[model samples]
Target: MMKRFLILSALISLSIFSSDKIGRLPVYKIAVEAVPATEEGIVLRDFIKEQIQSTSRGTISLPLKESESGNWEFDKEGNPTLETVANIKRYTDTDKLVLISTEDGQAVISFVDVLHRKLEYRNSLPDSLSKTLVSDFLGFLDKKNIYLALSETGSGSNAQLKINSLKPTYVAGEPIRFEIESAEDNYVYVVLVPENQKGEPILLFPNQIQNDNFVRKGDRVTIPDKRISFKASSVPSKDRIRAFASREEWKEFQLRGKKEDSFYRLLPPAVTGTKTTARSMTVVPNTLTASIEQSPVMEWEYQILSR
Candidate 1:
C-alpha cells in the first residue's frame, strides 16, 4: 500500500511539471478603452475585450471592470502609468482605473501597481489591425534564438551558431538581459569585436580546464533577431565565444504584445539598410556532430506584428 501511494505521488508530480507551461504571468485585472468614441471605438473596445479574455489566460488575469474616467501619465522617469492598478482586486468599484488607449495609428498600453505605486511594462504599437496580438505578447515570453560565434582549439574552424535573444526589445537605457540556465559546470565569456572587421568565433567549453570566465553558466546571449536562453547547467565555457555587435545596436530587438484582435503577434525590428528576416532562413538539423559546428535554427512563424 505504501509503495502504491509513493508511485501515485511521483506520477502526480510528473504530471504537474509536464503541463503546458504558461510562459507569461497573469495581469489579474485589465481595463481597456478606446480613445475618441466613434463607431470604430466601440468595435475596437469589444475586440480588445475578447482578445484580453482569451489570450492572457495563464499570462495575466484581466478581470472586467467599468470606470468613468482615466488618463495616461508618466512619472519623472517618463514611464507611463495605468491610473489605479494597485487595487486590481477591487477594480470594479473605484473610479480610479487602469487605462489602455488606442488612437489613429498608434496604441499605448500601460499598467501600474496601484498598491505599490510602481510602474510595470508599457509599450507602443504602430498602425496595425492584427487580431492575434495577445499571442504575439505571450510569444515574447517564450525563448528566442540568439547568434553565437565559436572557435575550435587547433582546427582553425571559425563559425557562428544562432542561439536565442531576449524579449521586450531592450531599450537604450535598459541593461542587457543575459540570464543563463545554471552555473554549476559552465562559464560564459564574451569578447566584443569591431563592427567592420571579420573575426573568429567565440569559444565555449564544458570542462573547466580553460580559464574562460567570460561565459558563466547563467550568462545570456543576444542576437540581432533572436534570444538565446540558457540555464547554468547547460552552458558551455571551453569554446572561445565572442560577439561583434555594438552596444548601442544591441538595444533593438523584436517585441511581443497583445493585439486588439485577441491574438498575439511578433513585431519585427525596425527596417534598416539590411533586410534580415527570420522567415527566409532555412531550418538547421537538430542533432549535429560535435566536431563540426551546428547551423543556426530558424523559425517560420509570424515575424510581423500585424496581420
Candidate 2:
C-alpha cells in the first residue's frame, strides 16, 4: 500500500484531472454510501466527483440522501433487481446512476445505466492504489482506463487538471527524497510555508523523510518552477512561502479551500512501513533549523541542525 491520504475536498473542487469520452452518454447522478457525510466521506467524494466528470464528459451531481442497506435491493441470486433499481432511480433525474461501496482496503464502483436498465460496469479497487476507481468504471463505457482517458479527454470535459513540466535545480537546500517504492505514480505535492519565528516549515508527502525547499532572504525564486503565481510576494509584512507539488498546474487535484482550514484535514500520522518506504532531503535556509527522524539519507541521526 502507498499510505493513502484521501483529500475529500480535492474531489469537491473537481479541479483535477478527469476522464472524458469514456462513452457518449453524459453522467448525471452518482449515489455514494452514507459514509460520505463523515470526515472520511469528504475525501472519497472529491475523488469520486473528479472521476465522474472526467470519465463521462458530463456534469455529476451527488445525491444528498444517505444510502441505506435497502437502497440497493438484490435478488435471490444477488444481482440488483430492476424493481429495486427503479426506486433508486427516482431520486436523481439523470441518465446514469453509480452505486459505490467501500471495504477494508478497496472501493467497489457499480455504474448503472438507468435508461438501459443494466450495469454498465463494475470494479474493485485496492487500498492505496494509484489508479482512480471512479474513472475506471466510467472508462469502462468505452473500455478504457481512466488514467489514459484523462489526458485524452481534453476540453470536452471540465475535469482536466493541466500540468506543466519544468526542471528545478537544488540550491543549498535540505531536500526530501520520497521513494514510495510501492505507491502509485501519483505526483506528490510539497509546500513550504512560513509558520513561526523559525521561518517557513516544509511539508512533504511520505512525511517519513526530511526534505525542504531552500531560498535566500532576497531571492525571488520558487522551486518546482511552475507555481510562481501563487508564490508571488504579499504585502503588509505577509509571510512569503514556497509551495510545490508532484505535478505543477494541478488543476485536476486541487483543494476547494485551504486544506488545513477544512473540517477534513491532511493528517500525516506515523504508520508502520509496509513494502514501500518514503524518504526526502531538505537543505536549510540561513540559520534556520529542522529536526529529522529515522531517514537513511540523513545519516540515521536524530538531531535538530541549524543552517
Tens-place lDDT per residue, model 2, 1-307, is: 0111111001011122322333323224445443324444456656666654553434565564544335565544435686666565665566556565556767666666555455656667774652455434433432212112221222222211122221121112223121211122223333332212122122332132212223223323223233111211211111211222222223222122232321111211111111112220011110010001000110010111222
> Highest lDDT: which candidate?
2
Runs of candidate 2 exceeding 4 Å displacement: 1-42, 54-56, 68-79, 130-132, 141-307
Residue 16 CA error for candidate 2 (Å)? 42
Task: Provide the TM-score for each candidate, comma-separated.
Answer: 0.30, 0.32
- Model 1 gets an lDDT of 0.29
Clashes of each: 70, 35
- Model 2 Cα displacement at 109 (Å)? 0.9
In model 1, the runs with Cα more than 4 Å from the true position are 1-42, 56-68, 76-98, 129-136, 139-307
How high is the CA lDDT of each candidate model? Answer: 0.29, 0.32
